[model samples]
Target: MKKSIAVDMDGVIADTETHFLNWYEREYGVRIGVHEIQGREENEMFPDKTVARKFAFTPGFFRSLPVMTGAVEALKTLMKSYDVYIVSAAMEFPQSLPEKLEWLKEHFPFISWRNIIFCGDKSIIGTDYMIDDHIKNLDFFKGTTIMFHAFHNVNHNHHQRANNWDEVLKLLVK
Candidate 1:
């Protein structure tokens, strides 16, 4: 069987939390702590369609987001061994998905659209390994979940906490 790897876009491949927090604060007029969003339910973070729609329409949201450290390098390494696919959550507005995808392409030209998989439920994708920052998704994947460490997730202990992409590459490639 061909080996496959599913990568999460927002947190794993890109440092989107910073942009998300900034956008949330600017739009909602309230500073949302990363910790508050980390373990909570998704609905609690984005309560209604209004909030979701606002996020989707936010200008330069994708362009402003930062790429995670060692993400590209790690992905390059994984690409050698497995079919790497970006299995991310679909945006509330489908149009927003393409923008986010374009942002990813601009940042990492090495990644192609054919390898990208945007969907709400990633568990159905059937990858041998999953690299994500969300603990909930990691739990759902039930594979060799490599938890890419972030500020909010740092406190939450996990079996596979990759401090950098080098470590993640090592784990996945081995």
Candidate 2:
């Protein structure tokens, strides 16, 4: 039996939090914290869906985002042993998920779309292990949850915490 690992995209594989924060601050003129940015409650921040859609459709959002340190290398290592699948929240804008995945592939060519899951509900996807940065998602998963720490999630206390992708790889391999 082949083991399966589910990986998150926004903060886990790609360091998109910074880019999102910058864009939010520039467009909304509000100095939002990283926690609020990743909270997934856009209604609290943006008054309407139009603004949210604008943010999602913004060109270069994918290109400007940076890959998380050691994410590509660690994924490569994990792929050697387990079936690694990327489970990410779909962008509100049309075609955003496909476009972003393409951009991500340019950076990490090892990942394929067949192994990617673009959905809002991650718990529905079956996987043996999960590496994510969100506390809510971690709580929803009933497997080995490795919390990837970020400035926003510094206060969250989980049984497993990985400061970087290398640490995550080490934990999974063990």
Candidate 3:
């Protein structure tokens, strides 16, 4: 039996930070540097506290996100050695379920629909390993946790860290 790994969709495989930065600049005509966002929550990245929520709730928001660098290839490689599942907290955003599935189909066609999990709480997951950006999810996971590095999560040292797909490959692809 293969060891299963549950991977978060947002900050881990999807370039949500970049999406926010780009959209923020387009909407506000103000460019926010990544350096300015360290240790801040996603909603706190903008001067207007509600902007992030608006962006997330906007149509095409999740579907238009860029794929994280090297994620496609790294996941493909990892799939050969482990049972990889793409898991996302899509219940919070009513429109995210279908958008996320479509995005996955476009960007990661190799992943089966059966392995995709869209849920509100990740604690129910029973994988052998989990990669996530949120402390809330990882904190409750019973498996080995990998904190995927994002500007928001930079200060957290609660779990093993992976700064990029290269780092993730090094940690779990062996």
Point to the candidate with the largest TM-score.
Answer: 3
The root-mean-square deviation over C-alpha atoms between each candidate and the true structure, in angstroms, is 3.6, 3.7, 0.7
Candidate ranking (TM-score, best to worst): 3, 2, 1
lDDT of each: 0.74, 0.77, 0.94
Clashing pairs in 2: none
Can you give the TM-score per candidate against the true fold? 0.75, 0.78, 0.98
Residues 75-132, model 2: lDDT tens digits: 8899989999988877444456767778678987878878988887677867998888
Candidate 3 residue lDDT tens string, 1-174: 999999999989999999999999998899999999999987799889999999999999999999999999999999999999999999989898899999999999999999999999998999999999999999999999999999988888979999999999999976
Mark the regions of model 2 whose C-alpha exceeds 4 Å error after superposition.
21-54, 91-95
Model 3 quality (TM-score): 0.98
